[model samples]
Target: MATVSQIWPFERRRCLKAHGIITLLFLDLCLQCVNGYLSSPHVGQEPPYSRDAQPVITSPVVPSPSSASPTDSDGYAAKCPSGGQCNRLPADCINCSYHHNCSYGKLASFSCKAKRGVHCTAESGKQQTNFSLSITCQFCWQLDLSQYRCSNSTSCMTVACPRKCYNATCQVLDHVHCLGKRVFQKRLYCNWTGGYKWSTALALSITLGGFGADRFYLGQWREGLGKLFSFGGLGIWTLIDVLLIGAGYVGPADGSLYI
Candidate 1:
């Protein structure tokens, strides 16, 4: 019926329709792969995205990816990675972690199956590496981290703690992940020694001891009563006073070592 030029319109329409269908199918396949389903019926192919998302901390990485682990002037220890694959994370990771940009390059294909109580913290804030955030992990039972905090009066639930305390009296305890999956009651306390001042503790003891409270507060139950019975140990007990002032030990209620 029609001239050669016009005759091809119908055929061209069919070709266009076929192309549109193929494009739709391709996009659908890509979507499935990005969603992390990995196994889609249509494509019958494995997903290319990794679902295991790693936690990125505010600290960059040990040695900037060019050198060894970041070192302290004293070289006592090397800086550890805040979370995982540091330095390799996206630059905006700090701002992106809590939102849609968590996966960065792998966003389309990567899905995180984090357990709330073990890996993630309920407290909203940035994660820090210089200041190690201490947390009490229930361990094993749950696949995520829920609540993590430093028991110090100046709580560190959300803030990154200092790298190290100076002359200030503080406790440093090493976290132990024992039994391969359980947290143990056992903790190694870095008892303050050598030369550190405890101005706050001294002030509290001297002012509060008149009521026998200071002695009791410092884990000297017997000494507290003795001091209470003896009126601040005015003269005779001055010798014991020296001992208490210099001695560093663990707080009874808490396992933290105090100076």
Candidate 2:
């Protein structure tokens, strides 16, 4: 066996070497753990589910108002009618629409000077001007009929009656002629007899003047009440009402003349 001192020194050296190897292995493990933690993706940041993300921004598309076309009250573009003197007629008839070949704007007013009709009148060495536009003037008979006369009695017609008169004959009585052979082609106005009768109204006024019967018959409710309450203005009003009704001065409440 070796001496005791020599054996003690050898064992001491082996213990120190084992301790150094363990220390080195521990330091290497610590360094590897630290490097792995630093290399991880989520080491210093919060989780994606922790908070709300910002929204992406983009430009909005909008339509231009000026790109839309104009429309009328009926939801249609106003266009001129195909036929007649629509080009010469007023723009108000169809909301300012005019013929494509027309020389002037449809809304513009022109003189009726050379135009053949009763509307054209000579005054102060100038032709009369027309600003009032009428659709009736587009028709032939409505434009002028001063030269024609109805051969039948005037009492046979009413304003509400149809244009066709089987019993009446339209004859050219004057030298002037109407355009488009409209002497009998279009409507003709004769004596107008309304719903109320003049003779009946006059009789009622004379007979029941104190009771307002005539006013009631003529559709004058307010006047009827006045006459009834005031006792026909103490008879003086009765006489005056009689004369007025007979003279055709007092008409129907509906603005229609008595027959």
Candidate 3:
């Protein structure tokens, strides 16, 4: 009876240990199932709970139409019609450029002088079918007509003169009365200021006439040498030169003007 009682007590201990182990295993399984059910639905999605919603405030500043920037047309003093006959009147002229819109394959023409401060308009329009319109003003050079006009109001014919002419007087050189026709030839002469002064020539002729000082001063080297060797042609040539120089009959040899 003592051996049987010891064996029965061991069997009860074994059964209690088994029941505790099974209870622990079952509790672990239930906890695992509850955790998987909580996290499985949101595996690839955002959390269901979030922060509190906030009101978004927008900017109140806005651009007004009256305060808009100005364009190029605002600076222009006038405007021209597009694809029509241009106004030739001075009152219809613009500050510089007359803007237009041109169709493709058609030319837009306008006249403007660049030297007068007129400029070519900037091209602005569609690329194809409609082309940008601009009128280019070329630089022009104008000749003064007053320089070619005569004092008598008569037009002067262009003539080749080696000596530059200024304030010329026109005169008829020859008139031919042949048959029934009259041929008139005119010539223009300038007031020439060339040659030595008559006063100086006369003074030299009176003072050193025998030595040919007057002739040398007048650029007549050959006459000067002749007078020097001939003793002023026995003093007769000297006396004649005094009269000739005073009468303004003598002139410079080179045919150039005096300083």
- Ordered by TM-score, highest first, the candidates read 2, 3, 1
Candidate 1, 1-259: lDDT as tens digits? 6888997998999999999999999999999777766444675766687645443423322222223233322332232223443222222121111222223222121112211111222234444322212222222222222222222232211111332232222222223210111332222123333222355445556566555665566566887788777876764464455346545332322323444
Superposed Cα deviation of residue 11, candidate 3 (Å): 99
> Which prediction has more favorable TM-score, 2 or 3?
2
- Across 33-80, the per-residue lDDT of candidate 3 in tens digits comes to 999988886667865765444212132122322333345334332442
TM-score list, all predictions: 0.24, 0.31, 0.30
List the global CA lDDT of all models: 0.38, 0.53, 0.48
The digit string of per-residue lDDT tens for model 2 on 1-259 reads: 7999989999999999999999999999999999999989968876567333321212212122232333432332133222234234322222221112222212322122112221322333333433223222122233334656655444543333243243445654332322223345333444444589988899999999888999999888888998999999999889999998887778676655576
Q: What is the C-alpha RMSD of each candidate to the true structure, in Å?
A: 27.3, 31.7, 39.8
Candidate 3, residue 78: lDDT: 45
Q: Which residue pairs of candidate 2 clash?
A: none
- Cα error of candidate 3 at position 48, Å: 99
